[model samples]
Target: MKQSNFTTWFKSGSPWVWMNAGAVAIAVIMTLGLLILIAVRGLSHFWPADIVEAEYTIPGQPAITLLGEVTTREQVPTERLQGAGLPVDPEQNEFMDRELLKVGNRDLYGADFRWIVADWLSNERYPEDVIAIERREWGNFYGYLLSVSHDGEVVAEGEQAIDALQAAVERASGIYDEIHSLETGAIGKINTELERLRLRERGYELDNALTADRQAELEAERAVQNARYAELESELVDLYREFNRDSIMTRAMDGQEKRISLSAIVRVFQPNAMGITDKIGHYFAKLWEFVSDEPREANTEGGVFPAIFGTVLMVLLMSIIVTPFGVLAAVYLREYAKQGFVTRTIRIAVNNLAGVPSIVYGVFGLGFFIYFLGGNIDQLFFREALPSPTLGTGGMLWASLTLALLTVPVVIVATEEGLTRIPRSLREGSLALGATKAETLWKVILPMSSPAMMTGLILAVARAAGEVAPLMLVGVVKLAPTLPLNANYPYLHLDQKFMHLGFHIYDVGFQSPNVEAARPLVYATALLLVGVIASLNFAAVAIRNHLREKYKALEN
Candidate 1:
């Protein structure tokens, strides 16, 4: 009966054991898969592709060199050849071309080429011409011409000069019309009056009543009219001079030359040799540049360095603000304070604070921090920085304080756990050695709990680093022109609004209309954040382990 009972019990328990093991195995597999996927996708962004050349000919036009795959004329469809306007004998084209080429698999015409089209013609009727060729077979007779031409300039200054000259001519035409109108109206009127006066004088002479006074008056009027005509003539001459085509063309050409020169300089400065690897390298380089450089207009290129600097500075400030208060609260509650209704209530409050919605904290931060504390600070300490509203507005210092408040519970809980784990006998032993309670707590208890304190700090840092909602209300901006730390009069200005990576991810992912382009960046940033937090946690754990080992003997 005992042997039967034992068998039954083993059978019942064995299934449960297998089930638990299976569950663990599945979890392990899933974790490995997730990690592998992340690494593969992230690192694949840096792979490079081979560059190739190909030739294409349009009938009646010179062969064009394209950088990509090469293909044989025979392999290319007759319709495609016809579309290119190449004369192909429909009956013999296939067989004759195939025999003439005698293309082998190893031949250049048969080789594959990779190319990106720099230019393509677009028309609905001939849609094939407009399509970009990513790859092509190189064995064709035309395939050899696709190599990059050393003489091909990306932009032609001569063409730009012609464009500018055309613009200038158009402008001059408008001015010419104005000048012509003035000349016709004023000068034509003067000429007509002169003719009328001459006619009147002829009549007077015929009547034989032409007096000296009349002649003098007529001469004076003629002289005045002639002066007006001369003035109009001079103005027209000036307008013609101003609108001179040669001068306008010369200026336009000069301006275009200068612009092209600057553009060439910029291009020269840019690294032009691009491969997949090179492109990925450039992306990271640019990201670093953005983080390190000063902020500029969104359309311009500059470093987002100010935002990065501000974010780091603000988080550090928050750590400074939260660490001492949280640790002290935790120490008092776990060690010094008696377990009572007040202590229980305080613990409840701390837990509740952790659960409160972050957005609610943001609202509270905006109202209480920006308006109440900032207003008071502005009135007291930052009166000189008024009108700019240094302390009486959203800023880095207030943002840090708000975030610190939000993460206080995380630090408190971690620190309290660290404190609770300290053996009571350690305190008793310290007292037996004639050490005072305060001294025992400081020297023995605090030292042993150092790892827990570090753990708390790490947790707090992680929470602060990722908190975006509170930052939005407190001081985080889409862009910050200057860093929080600078050589300006008072270094480390706390009143500046700053940019943060978490906020940046939010802005780029949600706020931006271009989701496709920003999506990759969002993933990259998220990966970076996770890496940073993981590294911090690992470091803290290492320290904790070392401390635990050091205190292992005392635990007994």
Candidate 2:
């Protein structure tokens, strides 16, 4: 009787329903758990962790002074520690506490991080005067301030040293900012103009139209550009001199004294002395810099603004190119094409294309769009830039076009589904009112299908924004400091390579020289990429919902 009751429940589908619900619940829990883990590990990278100084000892070695921020803690098997040639007493405990410390001053030690056995550490202390210095290069420096100097003379020391050092840093930083502005701004403009002039001259020379007077005119323009460049160069020299006029002396954990030029230092803060409010403020400041500044230190440091900008721009360009073409194709397939085997075969092919590997699309883009089509265009219009392959190279324009092609099938399928959903009575009613089929499609059919088109776009963007494989071949680069859009004429430079968050994460996570340093950043960049894609999809979904509501009456 009990067995029969169990069989009855299974046959009634109750057990199946319960199983499905359990699967769904488990999936949701796993997804949320992963996201939470990523958030905690990634976002904490920028927090102001208190610096700890301790005396580290081993069973057979003398103690060494260690100063660093505690990055992470974990438990290791005692056997694993002993296997690594560490003296671990397996009898004491089966597991051992292991801690990772970010010991800075890479120039001195040649390593930024070290894993130490926690059981051997003693005399842990947090000193208020110990400062952490963020530098433009060589990672970071952790030490105590010794003195401040101007040029080669000691200008401030003792009690007034920190205050004097801060003032000097501010001055040096201001000069550095000016020098940066000159390099990327004014000097950059000059470089662009020079390239344009050279290209123009090359075109004229290639066409055999370079008369003596024309040659002289080009030479005169070149001379003027050179003069401007010289003036800027002289100004830059002065700025560099002032920028390097100050320096700070510091004492490291090993009691070794080092002098760091203020020009190379980005910021100095005593993290252990910082209050809660100060740490919070510092965290936000670091976060903002990560979002707003250009990358530095081999794409590991600074902000990813360029990647964010390029990803958005490429997606926008793809949307603009794909929408009209996909809609027209869908219109032809569903409304104009005859309901025969040919149309059926074409629809089958389109659906199959959607499942093709993304890397395959990347290869297609590289071969056809860049090598064949782009090379031909460069040959026809940019003959003077031959061999240089201006348009023939992988660039943002080709990347956008490649993505448009890859996603157009999705749009076609979506729009076709939307077209099929519209009632035939609506078309008949429009025709009865003397409207042509074209007019009916434009005014009635297309409006009702608008939501589906947006759905296609959202899907396309969601997939494309996180795509690293295709973009690596087409346009995305490991580093692209200069943005595509600028104040220069022909404002948008589509032929230039750009950065993407997806590729940035791959490069940081897999190719970085610093493993531990890049781990948290891998999480952070992954989170940022997800956020960016989500933001784009959310906007599209909102539009889709609005369109659906607006066309509800027509659909009914």
For TM-score, the strongest prediction is 2
RMSD in Å for candidate 1, one decimal? 22.4
State the C-alpha lDDT per candidate: 0.60, 0.91
lDDT of 1 by residue, 1-556 (tens): 9999889978889878988999999999998787666655543332322223334444456654443222222344455545555565556544222211111111233232322221221121211111121111211121111111111332212334334333444565567567756755567567768866776675567668789988998899999999998888898887776654322111110122101111111001012235456667755755565445453323122344555566567767887999899989998998889999999999999999989988888899899989998898877765444555768888888888888888899889988998888888888999999999899988998888877887887888788878888888889998775567754435677888888878876876787543433444555555555665576567767887898788877766
TM-score of 2: 0.97
Q: Over the full model, what C-alpha lDDT does candidate 1 score relative to the true structure? A: 0.60
For candidate 2, write residues 1-556 as lDDT tens digits: 9999999988999988999999999999999998888889989999989999999999999999999999999999999999999988888989999999999898999989999999999999999989999899888899899999888899998778988888888888889889988998889988988888888889999999988998899899989989999999999999998888889899999999999999999888889989999999999999998888887777677788999999999999999999999999999999999999999999999999999988999999999999999999999999888889888998899999989988999999999999999999999999999999999999999999999999888888888787889998998999986888886667899999999998999998999888888888888888888889999999999999999999998677
Residue 155 of model 1, lDDT score: 26
lDDT at 535, model 1: 65
What's the C-alpha lDDT at position 74 in model 1? Answer: 36
Give per-residue lDDT, candidate 1, residue 341.
100
Please state the error at residue 80 of candidate 1 in Å.
Answer: 28
Judged by lDDT, which candidate is best?
A: 2
